[model samples]
Target chain A: MKAEDVIRFCGRSLAGYPLRTGLMLLAMAIGVAAVVLLTSLGEGARRYVAGKFTSLGTHLLIVLPGRSETVGGPPPLLGQTPRDLTVDDALALTRSSAVRRVAPLMLGSAPVSLESRSREAIIMGTTADMFEVRNLEMAQGRFLPPGEVGRAEAVCVLGQKLRNELFGNGSPLGAFVRIGQRRFRVIGVLTKKGESLGTDLGEVALIPVASASALFNRASLFRILVQAQSREAIPRAKKAILQIIQERHEGEEDVTVITQDALLATFDRIFKALTLAVGGIAAISLAVAGILIMNVMLIAVSQRTGEIGLLMAIGAPGKQIQRLFLSEAAMLSLVGAAVGLLLALAGHWVLARLFPEFPLSVPIWSPITAVGVALATGLIFGVLPARRASRLDPVVALSRR
Target chain B: MIRLESIERIFQVGDERVFALRQVDLAVRSGEYLSIMGPSGSGKSTMLNILGLLDRPDKGVYQLDGRDATHLTDRQQAEMRRHKIGFIFQFFHLIPRLTAAENVELPLTLAGVDPVARKECVAAALARLGLAERAKHRPDQLSGGQRQRVAIARATIMRPALVLADEPTGNLDRASGTEVIHTIESLNAEGMTVVMVTHDPELGRRARRQVRMLDGRIVSDSGAGHEG
Candidate 1:
């Protein structure tokens, strides 16, 4: 048969049973839409986390006290206590040529009261270099003054939310605020940064590292942030910090150094796998759709047995009959896939409008993969019914009606 | 021309083997009109199916146009049917979804005839069958006589050498039956070999040659001596 005639014949057959054809198309379309939307959600989450990491500043390394071993068991309750990472260790990291700057962190919660207004806020104690290392911006006044690392400067930078709570809309810079038992002047106010890593940057108060040690009455630092000279210097800077800490602690590698690339790479791998797994789960629906096509096609073969017999009597080969049915299936799948792609895109658009901050997008390969798998499913599942129709006994078929 | 020799067709019903057609020998020349008449289960339909190549005989050497047709492959048999044979059925087996013109164009379309030529042929055939105005009407919309005429148009659209009709007017009223009989008779008058199977003695007698079957055997043939 001519290709166009075959198509027209199949088209007429499908159009003859509108309800059955529409339901099958709906099933196939839902399967494809599910795959594309779920994968896009997974990819969106991956990009969101990656964006957060990029905002944590480039070529950075985090140094924390004690090794975090991932053994397949519960952590030891009475594990060996590692040496404390001090402000001296932070100063020692600055000597490496690969390291651009180091900011030692000391975290503690304290009540900050300005006159009668009081609220408990997290205190972040770091050096002046922290503003550059952590990508913090100043909304008013200047950041911590660049001076001696050990100087116990009685000055602080209030977070945007903290300043709002303490002084409302009024300027809080240069005002004295009592944190715990000591009074410090608010030297700067941070911009309206939201969340980073897990910390709400808009809710903390930044203070000098030495002043935090005196206020919290501890010599040990919480963690150290090191910035490498360039993207390629991150590994070298991590090694230098580890070696410096080990040497300072009398030949013991007590501190764990993690680079930004390593952390980002780990998250990247995790989310990619998650996307593929979700896409795989959605593919099961496509298989179900394929089975539906097979079932319906089988019914169609039986329902149109008389018509098939007529074709055979009029000189259609068995192969032509098979092609007719197979092309019907292929046409259904192709149009269904197209409709599904449109559905997914519309879903993405609606979701993006609802959550504008999220990086909502459909991955390029998802549509291609969905359509390809849909076509394959149609053909593969179509084989049985087509073969049955082709092998029908025309005489017996014609005698039925 | 068509020839059949020692044809045997068996059916397995429960534990017993039933003979549908036994030792059937028949020869038909080009452009001749003939009819086979029999009661229910007399193997007349079986003969038509075997002659139409819709069924295979258990033991026979069948030839059409001097070519061995009994053992031809399924594809080759379909090709032969495409170019050399036409069929009209009792219920006028027209696909309900297609229009009269499209249904008539089926054989030519399957033969890969170009759309323009196919359209012209279908239109001419429909016009010739007195269904020119009903060409765009579906089978369900056409009257019984009109539907049978559409089937006739379809059967002759391929310009086949032979036409086989198995009770073509079996389901129609008296007037429609007479109309359909006249249509096929006209095709036979135009030098196309026509073989029809029917239960109506009146219709069977209208053909120049008549064969009567009983219990899977041909009991009588008026044109027995005219075999090619």
Candidate 2:
């Protein structure tokens, strides 16, 4: 058929049953909008979590203590329970070709004192490599060296928040401080690294790991934090580290290796499942829209049986009869898809405005899927009625009063 | 040529089959004008329907140009109706949604005649029917005489070999009825065969050959033999 004829047919589609077409489009639009809006929100939450983790030096790894041995619970790996990683382990990992830096991380809360001011602060103890491992830069003085570490120097680097609380933005470097009854000199203050994953990074102080071990006096190791040269070497470095750690433990495996890729894959699966759930729920309403289209088209077939017969008697072939009606149905679906796209866009725009940090991510694929669904819906649901129209015996139909 | 042999048309109202036409034989030569007349249930409409190919006789051989048409598929019969046979109904069945010219133009359109040629033919038919001025008016807008003339224009637009008009003027008064009959007869004069069914004896007698049906059978056939 010519383009004009196709356009004319679509016009007929609208004029045939304006109310029904309007209602079906509305149903599709509302359903699509809700799906897009809710899915975007979920995506935004995932993005925010990923962003927080990304801020703490994308390469940093946290290793926790192995499980404690209980009476009848999980078995120990490496033939040991609650195995403690030591400073030597961190040093061993750094020697690998892929390894860029390593830091033994020790964390505890301590009441920090400066002048007459004292505030409870989260304290981190690590080698000078912690600066490179975390991509951390000091706002004042230098990080303590290995000489200072070996001597167990009474010097500390204060986090920006702790420094500000003690001295209100004035230079706090070279100030005297106390942690757990031990006097220390504040040799440096760290550039502000704000809250991450809801843990305030600003309220912290750094010292030598040996000094921390001496001060805390609880020598069970925490974890060895390591960074590889690049993301490409992370997995290889991890594998080598695991093997070495294994060799050190007499070939007994205790540590679990994790990567950002693995974690992201899990998130992908989770989001995918959520997408299916959302799409499935959206499709229920779409199914209702399909039913509405079908019911109306069926009623239309019955009503136009005579008209169909008249056309057939005049020489319209069975296929043409089927095509005309089916075209009408398909046009309805396309209209629905268009309206659905608009509604989805509108919903996304409104939601994105409400939360600046939460981005409403509109994937181009979702609307394309909706359009495909509508087309399939038209063909599937419209076929039966179009067939009915095509199958009507012209003689009987035309003879009707 | 048109011929009907041993025609029987049985209708099942509910349970029993009633033969609307039984052992009915009739014919009309090419270009002949004929009318079949009978009471309501006496099978006049049945005869018209069979001759028109709008229906098939239950037990008979129907020939158009000596081709047995009774065995043709429904689509083939519809094509025959489209290109060779035409119908004019009493109610003036002019497709209320279409203008008079469009209704007149429908048969040619269905035949897939080129649009420009179809338009020329439609214009010629309208001029012949003297409805050139009323072509744009829909059936509801056209007067009785005008609508019947439009219907006649539609029937003859294809220059079909046969025109089956069932009570074409049964719904019109004499002045309008005469105009419609004249329009149809003019086509017959131009060598198109016309077979009409009507209740009015005066109208029935106007045809060159007259058929009288009674009790599901032909009672008399005048002015010609049983083959055309």
Q: Worst ten-residue run, lDDT, model 2 chain B?
A: B219-228
lDDT of 2 by residue, A1-401 (tens): 34445456456546756787788677656655555555665666666656665665656555445533235757555454645677666677767887787788887889998767889988777888877776777778887665544456788888788888998967777778899888888888888766665657689888888878888876545677778778888888888788777777667556665555566667767876776677668767777777777888898888766667666655666777788778877877887778877877877777767766664575556667767777678778889888998888766766653
Per-residue lDDT over A340-378 for candidate 1, one digit per residue giving the tens place of the 0 to 100 score: 988888898999999988898789999899999999999
- The stretch of ten residues in a row with the least summed lDDT in candidate 1 chain B is B219-228
Name the DockQ score for candidate 1. Answer: 0.82
> Interface RMSD, candidate 2?
3.1
Worst 10 contiguous positions by lDDT, candidate 1 chain A: A69-78
TM-score of each: 0.94, 0.78
**How many clashes show up per model?**
0, 0
User: Which DockQ values do the candidates obtain, in the order shown?
Assistant: 0.82, 0.30
For all the models shown, what interface RMSD does each have?
A: 0.7, 3.1
